[model samples]
Target chain A: MSDRGHLKKTAHLAEVPAALEAGPRGAKPRRLVSTRTIVVYGTLFVAAAYYLLPLYVMIVTSLKGMPEIRVGNIFSPPLEITFEPWVKAWSSACTGLNCDGLSRGFWNSVMITVPSTIISIAVASINGYALSNWRFKGADIFFTILIVGAFIPYQVMLYPLVIVLREIGLYGSLAGLVIVHTIFGMPILTLLFRNYFASLPEELFKAARVDGAGFWGIFLKIMVPMSLPIFVVAMILQVTGIWNDFLFGVVFTRPEYYPMTVQLNNIVNSVQGVKEYNVNMAATILTGAFPLLVYFVSGRLFVRGIAAGAVKG
Target chain B: MTGQVTGRATVRAHPGRPSRLTRNLSAKIASIPMMLTAVVVFLGGTLWTVLYSFTSSKLLPRLKFVGLDQYERLWAAPRWLVSIENLAIYGVFSLIFSMVIGFMLAALMDQKIRFENTFRTIFLYPFALSFIVTGLVWQWLLNPEHGIQSVVRAMGWTGFDFNPLYDSSIVIYGILIAALWQGTGLVMCLMLAGLRGIDEDIWKASRVDGIPMWKTYLFVVIPMMRPVFVTTLVIIASGIVRVYDLVVAQTSGGPGIASEVPAKYVYDYMFQAQNLGQGFAASTMMLITVAIIIVPWAYLEFSGGRKRV
Candidate 1:
């Protein structure tokens, strides 16, 4: 209590000189109480409200009956709470003849995402290892090109990629999608692992080399274990990016292999007839659930990974 | 005596030069796969895109040379023009708003507050959700007939009218709001890391001088966090160019193409509108515009003016 009293006195004393210099003589100074905390919390609360308002609306809309949603009371609870829309969104909502809701796209997304993540991360790690550990000729040039390539909007490359994939007879296939994701993901992934590797002490690689380990040997036995944090970060990023990818999935995959985002888009953006807000909300939530789960569970590691140079490039 | 021994060691090391050649050869051989990845995938993809932009390619690649026709159409199209214009506005607003709001959020959380992790997670959960979901959710919330407007009106406040999404003039701002919601979390996280990484001595020194926290953050802390800020700016700029799904999901470039971003325009023409030539041209234009803006920035960033370290 005494320390608190002292803190208040000192805090007041710190502010009085500025007030005395700026305000009228003997004017009652405004309370020098710590409004910093008030302003901070107030701004944060407003921001959080702004951030979470849509999520609240989505949840409320999803829970409400269609009639209630149609009435436009997005914040109000339905007179009858029903999970029917969720059921419909998952099992029976029509996107063309496939009325199996977004579940149709679920397996396709997993197939696309799993391989894309693995191949991209594996390639990136190898690239990162090679660039960081090996002083090979033109290594710097190769790294520069790769980093610059990351900044090129893939939209620019999309038309050309379609042709290239078509020429290789891989166009509109799962493999094509995988290859595209891998190519696009490589820059950021390589940058991530490269930065992580560069930050590591070089002695480890030297020791591995002295032990007669080849390039791959040093990477597998030493670098992989040591780079778990960066790898987790890579996986989080690749998973989210590739899984949520709509354009690539639409362009590269055939109809059967459409990812959930694509399917959700079709369902929600259907230009014909009335748009069902309830079903759309449910489907949107369903489609986003995986990444949201990953974010919530691994947010701390994600932040750490980013701070550790996963996103620095 | 040590110098004489080292000289003798150098002379001895010269004899193993032939074996070193064999090792060098092996290292060269091992680099081939990486070289192929860079040349074929990264460089090849980019080169292919550039080449195709010149061709009159459709759903399938027809290699007929169209020269500057696609580029001409891209410039002439009203939707394409709108897309470019919308992107510029969206980019500026989203970057500034997200950075300011994110820094504010991070600063507030940095005050050693209660439930810091909970608040951080809440702010960040949006980033985890795809732009698709963000767009969908926000679209639903901002819909005039059925969303926040009607909900508030139902609460007996008849003057409540929040329908930015439906208004052609301001719908891009609606999309920007959704983008900022997702993006600010990332900025907050990055800035928080930057804030936490700040040397404790600076804070201690400032406290001893009786400087307030606000002044310290404004004058002292932010300048030190410049690298982090620049990194955030580059990342956010890239996100701006890639602004496809959010606009597609929310407005569908609706209310008369108000939110038509370049990516979406290219996509619509390439896929639905069946104008592949124009689409590729638009794609090329976007690529060039982005390159024009970003290449210089990337060069400056990587060229050691502000080194990554």
Candidate 2:
């Protein structure tokens, strides 16, 4: 199928002499319950158990009454399952002075993620198109800086960004967090889109140009229509990323605007009050639920998104 | 008259040619956001932080040059020392364990196994959750009374004292457990992709040569996956330096400052302690750490790019 035919054919011809000289050798067919098979399956089973342990513990613990959790070990199944912890975690869990629970944080995250994902994706898609197709002089310099900047710890830029946001009167607002997300998301998303757009047939872009289409015309009509899968990949990356963020949400926003992860941390780790492990586990699951849903639903594409990031990174 | 003027202009021009500024006008306009982000946030913000790290700013940032006073204090602080030591331990272990364990998991999965998808999904699901969640779950699991210790004790292993979160010496390991759980799945995925990229002929060739599977993976496959290894190392290293939220949620650097991390150091000094200079100095150190890893990788990538071209 490829240009390797000649090489393979030559190898086979050379192997013919070796086979004639030494005769044929064969590997013993592996039995279904061979030692190797047992080892592989056994190790995998143990790993799966280890990996699944915390989730199992979290679920059963969340369902059990406080008395049972106190008396029994974490791994045991709930003797009597109840949804009270989930209810209380959703509705009345106190995070500091606020008792409204993770729902508020959930809504805030939705507000933050929806806009941030859209705006970041919009800005980055255009950036990628320009880099891949428009080919302006010195564009690579900025792109290089952006990629390098991605590796820098957020602490270096946090205070400076706070200053900029304060000067613009958006420091404590949701919009400020949105802008921060967009800025941070730019590097990876741009790289993702750039690689993708670069891989598209070059003739398609040339034909669009030949038809007298301008930059926006080609992007909106041609690139956008053809890049639905990539856009979805971008969304998957952004949605999960923005949803899971805690640092920026804490550093940039007031408590009222804290994202779910930050709020979940606050609710669980608040120093006052009796520690409710059941409610805490419920809240933790609630906070993680959105990203897990996306990861599950977007299974292969989710893997593809991260794989694209890894291969390029 | 307008038509006559246009005609004269058209006749004078050999062909339609736009100046550089206007040639890609729409593209340039669209790139304004990218330019602003790069120039203002990435470049400008980094420069600003490094510059201000020199001053003895507190509560409010000021231009009173302190001449490394902040770094002097930063180095002298026991808490900072603890943070650095924890980070070193965490970084080394995180790097080694992640590579070894992640590769092993990936290799096992690559064995033409059934239920591969199910195993992969289970391993990676933790990665979907935030570090905060991972920390909390592990914290609950490691609780001295009601968690692993209790369960082990109940199983007649009463001498089991496995409370890493409570002990000052092993608190960082507690955080490491959560971080590895949250991250190894990603490393596995990357390694899996790398494994998939190897040519099928390589495997057949190894088999024909009667090489053991482990030997093939070790001697042949690994050498071919050098680029992926380097990339993964860079990623894991950078992430190691930024380990903050997990520590915060798990132990909050508690039982004293046993689990203090550099990122947490920066945040606490800046926001809580109101010591801007200390925070700036600490953050600058973090930047230096990242640069140490990223610069050489960039050089390699640049060279690799040339070779590919």
DockQ of each candidate relative to the true complex: 0.39, 0.54
| Candidate 2 C-alpha lDDT tens digits along B109-141 | 987678999999998988888888999999999
lDDT (0-100) at residue B269 of candidate 1? 80
Q: Whole-model lDDT, candidate 1?
A: 0.79
Task: Report, to 2 decimal places, the DockQ of model 2.
Answer: 0.54
Q: List the residue pairs that clash in candidate 1.
A: A72-B146
Q: Against the unseen true structure, what C-alpha lDDT does each candidate score?
A: 0.79, 0.88
- Which regions of candidate 1 deviate over 4 angstroms? A1-34, A306-313, B1-34, B55-67, B204-213, B304-309
- For candidate 2, lDDT tens digit of each residue in A11-47? 4554454455455563233453387889998999999
Q: Evaluated against the true chain A, what TM-score does chain A of model 2 have? A: 0.90
